[model samples]
Target: MVVGSMISQIELVLNELPESEKKVAEYILANAKEVMHMTIHDLATKAEASSAAVVRFCRSLGIDGFPALKIRLSAEVENTPHVGYFDVESNETVHSIIDKMLSNTILTFQNTASQLDAQSIEQAVSLLQQAEVIYVYGIGASFIIAEDAAQKWLRLGKNVYAISDRHLLAAAMATKSENAVFWGISYSGETREVIQLIKRAKEQGIKTISLTRPGNNKLSQLADVSLFTSRAPEAQLRSAATSSRFAQLFVLDIVFSAYASAQHDFTVEQLAKTRKMIEILYD
Candidate 1:
């Protein structure tokens, strides 16, 4: 059986493999289930190659070696049926609607995994931590994500501003320098106002970061550090701000958590102080 999405990856580089390595790749793709239990020597022998050739094959796929390749295979099998948008049928029952919505959200998160890269996430966190101020700009539903982001960073004592108005965001961008950061949120990565704000930040020599769906778009292309969320395709019912919104939030939560973790002591103290102040208001 074709093991999982790895098959597609293997196929993509199939033609590029040397003749002997091609044998091993073909063997793995054809016997994916059986190969999961096989050692490198076992695979190499079966494919009429040596253990070293198997290692070479694994590296070609960007995997560390045979063991790591097998682990990836297992995960692919489990994570198959990759998330795709599913439209809600007209006149659907309330129960079905609930299930559909929950399923869609779950799929959105799953899809985001493929869009994210470790290097970009780490770089974004480091930039966020180093910056003295952060300006977040978005419009419509994306602005809600910007608000959520500002609130999260604020708890950690980061100076995060979520500005929905175009003029205000541009003004804030104008006053900032490279010491500040501009974080733009646009699912399509083409939100005009958001784009202009990030552009302005860049003009002021501010570092710019962006969150958008996975694809080439103006805003992401404009920012210094471009980040991507899941690509939720258009569907009749899901054509709204459903999957993209969740993906953006997921990315923001990850970045915020990473930032907070990096400065654990300070973040904890800030959280405690904020909590106490809020509690006093309620009391």
Candidate 2:
């Protein structure tokens, strides 16, 4: 089976594990590709559990042993392309910036595309298309992307709610149902408030989506559909966030445009009406 199939299977079996084994199960589910590259000791260390626990965790998944599990995981990783990371220097020239930015953007697209599951994107778009209410939450730089998503969906005639206030957003999530979609955008995927809101949405049975950097993080683990941006490591000046943010928003635009194209006539009419309204206002 393919890596995506393995991941789907793991997700299906995740809730069946005992509470003690669940932690390791969660870690494996979130970090399946990365786990293949890690040693048994390294995997145990990262999961903050012992080797015995890790073995038991694998057994719970119906794998014969760690080596067999690792072999299957390695196959999954081999099928996926690797992402590259570059560091930017402080005194970089304009030409250097252009070159680095282009490289970073290309790498970001490649990485994101490699990890993109067509079914998940389709599922997310379906949820967004049918959602009666959509709430987006993010903090700092991610907040900007959340706002972008809100704007795009709003223009497409969807009811979008994006607020910077954590408490207010959490309250909004409480009143929503499966017809509502809560999107959580975070780069590190460990942002406390975003994670908290997504958790609340999950408890409320609201559809949840996450956009974050490619890695194992709490936000992705809890999300119904997880979309990853490129993994750009931060420097002293924090150029990573700056470049990756644009890349992520670009992906969002692609998703929005694709969705609009899928409903071409309706979206076209909507766009024309919006333009006419704006033109009348300007006149």
Candidate 3:
């Protein structure tokens, strides 16, 4: 099987592994590519398990041995590039802050561009195009992203809503079905309220998409389509969040534009009509 298939397999059987094996499983799931570069001894040490346990874990996954597992992991690592954001230091001068933020933002765009798959993006656009309604949900800083998504879709004459109130959003979701699409934006991919809403959407048969930092997180596990932003580690200055959020929003804009272009004439007509309405109101 290919690396992607192996990943799906691992996700499927993760919870079924024995306790000793579960530790190894969790670590591998979280750091598949990193583990590929490590020796059995290294993996055991890093996972806080034993070499024998590592072998057993591989066996549970139906791989021949550690080498085979490593090969699969290496394939996955090579296929997916890692992107990370750094924070500025406290007491840094103004010039230093500018430099650090610039470096972080540049790296973020580079990393995000490298990992993005055009086909998956097209699929996302297709889903959005077919949906009767789009509901965007996020918390805190991510709420800003949700609002941005709503505004973009609305501009295209799509029925889009961004609900800031957690209770009202959950209630609204309960009324939506497969015709609706729920977009959950969370940098951590483990926001409790967002996760709950995702589950509710799933129960109601609504398609779900997630935009989050790449990691083995709850949101990715739950969503139908998972679009990742570059991971941004926490810092005292909170510069990481600032850069990562911009990167996430950029990816969202790309998806929206792709969808709009697919319906070029319709989009043009919609824009013309909107402009005319605004002109009439203003005049």
How many residue pairs clash per model? 0, 0, 0
Model 1 Cα lDDT, one tens digit per residue, 102-208: 87787667556655777888899988988989898888889899999888888777787897778877776676665899999998889888887887888888998
lDDT of 2 by residue, 142-177 (tens): 899999999888877888899999998888778766
For residue 221, model 1's alpha carbon misses the true position, in angstroms, by: 1.3
CA shift at 128, candidate 3, in angstroms? 0.6
- How far is each candidate from the true structure, as Cα RMSD in Å? 7.4, 8.4, 7.4
Candidate 3 or 1, higher TM-score: 1
User: lDDT scores for all predictions?
Assistant: 0.79, 0.75, 0.79
**Looking at candidate 3, what is the lDDT of residue 279?**
93
lDDT sort, best first: 1, 3, 2
lDDT of 3 at 108: 64
Model 1, TM vs. native: 0.73
Candidate ranking under TM-score, highest first, comes to 1, 3, 2
- Residue pairs whose backbone atoms clash in candidate 3: none
Deviation of model 3 at 42, angstroms: 14
Candidate 3: stretches off by over 4 Å: 1-86, 279-282
- lDDT by residue for model 3 (1-283), tens: 3233345445545666778778888888798878888899998988889999999888765467999888877765677554334467668799977777886787666555544567768778878988998989999999999999998888778888899997888788777565889999998899999999899888998888988875468997898888876555456777767867887888898898898899989988888888888899987
Measured against the true structure, the TM-scores of the candidates, in listed sequence, are 0.73, 0.68, 0.69
